[model samples]
Target: MDDLSKMGIDAARLPGWLRFVVVIVIVALAAGASLAAYRWYARPVTLSIAVGSLDGDAPRIVSALASRLAVNNAPVRLKLVETGGPIESAAAFSSGKTDLAVVRGDVGDLSQAQAIVVLTEAVALLVAPPGSAISDIAGL
Candidate 1:
């Protein structure tokens, strides 16, 4: 204590009320820093998504997903970017304008893209009367 006072940095010399206030200030600063760190860690990550469709189904689906994520307080959120169609969406994704995109498998350049989900599938079927001459696709 004597050495600290000689160095002009003695805590023991502080008045009782002043020392209490100093301790309170230090604790408050520590608590504020902890809160700031927690907020930064808990913040959600937002990703931009490019979507396009002639019938508007792609945009609608993506919007619904974004809304659901927000409502569920998900850690990852989406921001929808509506392009004209699959080609435009693919272009946006390929050009690095968006982080994710909804595009058809056969549309545009997809060499750098990987399919995450199959949204739709198509199958062909033909029906004819039992006595009909149509037995194959060429018979029609």
Candidate 2:
């Protein structure tokens, strides 16, 4: 006990079999922790995606895709960002505020943007009341 105290080890009061069992349990715990660490490093990557609103469809679509990626344990996961409109979303993407963004081609300067996925084509429509004689919006 004096010799053990000199060496700074405190296992003197433990029985042989109890010490062996303790050592085995410690080894098992270490192995389990190592396994967990490996699993965490081996899991999928996460990415951020920005989408706009006021059309309201883009954010929902991106969110659904993110959910699907998580459900399948995909190699990549998307984090969605919601900006108010297409121009704001494009600005966010161009300014390096986000990793990915859904922006309209004509909305803002897209020199910094690249193609990832092209979803659909959309057209803007304007409606006028009947017998109003409003041929053009600028003339109204």
Candidate 3:
């Protein structure tokens, strides 16, 4: 009997099952790479963010978030429209001018538009004279 390795064409050289597994692995890897490339090169999503006037923290935070998104290849185009506070935000939302807003909770009733994401707290600075004292809530 001739040895399998000594034969010119030998089934023992590489098992049929092993060949099937290698082909499957190559196909899976190709599919995964195609999916990743599609996700990376997709068009940037457009998001309209309604914020207060170009003043302080709100604008700064929005800018930072936009920048970070851009860096991550998920570009965000911010369309900042000036408004008073939450009330204005609600109105802008109702009119469909903005997709999101930085608004105050105390801006009266918000029974119109649905809240997407709520930002908890915002720091406000009160600058007064050296000898000034805030006796009551009204003073602030």
**Pairs of colliding residues, candidate 2:** none
* Reference-based lDDT, residue 102, model 2: 89
Using Cα atoms with residue i matched to residue i, what is each candidate's TM-score against the true structure? 0.86, 0.63, 0.46
Model 3 lowest lDDT segment of ten: 105-114
- Which residue ranges in model 1 land beyond 4 Å of their true spot? 1-3, 7-9, 127-132, 137-140
lDDT of each: 0.92, 0.86, 0.72
Judge candidate 2 at residue 33 and give its lDDT.
100
lDDT of 3: 0.72
Q: After aligning candidate 1 to the native by TM-score, how far in Å is the CA of 83 from where it should be?
A: 0.5
What value does the lDDT take at residue 26 in candidate 2? Answer: 100
- Candidate 3's displacement at residue 50, Å, is 0.7
Query: Can you give the lDDT of residue 56 in candidate 2?
Result: 94
Candidate 2, which ten residues in sequence have the lowest lDDT sum? 5-14
- Compose the digit string of candidate 3's lDDT tens values, residues 22-95: 99999999999999999887767777877764356777777787778877876556556657655676677667
Which predicted model would earn the best TM-score? 1
lDDT per residue (tens digit) for residues 19-132 in model 2:
899999999999999999999998888877778878698899899999999999898999898898888888888888888888767888788778887778689888888877
